[model samples]
Target: MQDATPSAIRSAGPASLETRLEEAARYALLRRLTPALRHHMIGALQPLGMLAAMLERRSQAPAPDMASITKKSNEMGVLSREATAACVGLVAWITPKTADAVSIADGVKDCLGVLETDLALRGFIAVNEATEATALVARAIMRNVYAAALLAITDAAPGPAEVIMQSRQEGDTQIVSITLKPREAEPMGIGGPSYRALDWEDVEALAKAEGVVLEHSATGAVLRIAP
Candidate 1:
């Protein structure tokens, strides 16, 4: 008797080794960022939880204080707006907007926002010094490569460090540079999300996949993006 059964299904495989490697790198980057992303969501919604409990208690009172209830309602409205904005911003990191172009300054800030808490725990501070220059680059490419570059730089640091992100336009290309500034005096912390920091190879893979040019140096790396 021959047993015939279908094996578990999986998505179509990568077309080439390069494609496989690139996919692997992307997944690795996402795993490394999950903890920080989770923290951000919780932080954004924590206030709402507290306010909800307060409103519930007030509403249940035998003689509800209408004036107090109105004040809390107003407060809740403000907090709701803030929480919504925070969550929406966080979503961009996971699923970027469909627009073909994004502002260099905003892109840099968005990446740092997702990584700031995680980096701080790993003993690194990220500063967005990019000017308000718009670049014809996809958000996904900027995010993945920028994040990988940050991890690579900090991973090489011996102690606390400050990473400054800057961008400029030269001719037909926009250059986003990540520079590392060592901070030996400041103490580094130990508690953070447990994940391997991305390396140069990962950055290269991502850059290749997105058709972006990369220049690596002792200090840092620069990404040259073209429309």
Candidate 2:
């Protein structure tokens, strides 16, 4: 993806939002816009819009060539899917709810699968272990955690990001550890610790909602899903 996170952050600003809204209205009223404002709006919403169109096509089309669709749609399409996944995940379990029986390994893989194109574009190399810590945990927990990790990796990495995930079992728990290697020659100062920490805490909360135990250690975030 094109690091829309920066634009997403800018859009979150009170002043920026007000300005964007006013400019939007101004353009609509005059049926014209300053090139700058037009560019800004395009940068902000194009990915989401394109992704939606692709999704509509996919839903209506039968056995479409997913590889071709994804290949052509590119990063924006991936962003759109990620956004949809996040929205669905939030509504499904972020509120008061119980675990929905799901294949934890499959869920993680599905979430990661969305980012493969972006990862390749960014010149990053990643490997997922052949073994999976398959657990019958809440589908939301797996999706949220894996998505959060991908979001973080995308944000922090500048040149190339290396990702490795290990999955196995411990007694009655299924454990998965994710490790991210940032770009060389500089410390990670992209979004700061607060962003990563908030993502971390959110994953924990997501797991807790599913009655799963989660811990963060030096190696990586450890997920212990009880079967």
**CA lDDT of every candidate:** 0.79, 0.55
**lDDT for residue 154 in candidate 1, whole number 0-100:** 76
- Most accurate candidate by TM-score: 1
TM-score of each: 0.84, 0.45
Please write out the lDDT profile of model 1 over residues 96-201, one tens digit for every residue. 2255566877778777778787778777777778857666578777688878777777776677878888888888888899988888765655753467767788
Q: Give candidate 2 misplaced runs (Cα > 4 Å).
A: 1-100, 119-123, 130-134, 153-159, 182-198, 217-219
Off by over 4 Å in 1: 1-15, 96-99, 191-193
Clashing pairs in 1: none
Model 2 vs truth, CA RMSD: 16.0
Candidate 2: C-alpha lDDT: 0.55
lDDT string for model 2 (52-119, tens) is: 68766885686887876667567765676776665554334333334666666676665555545445
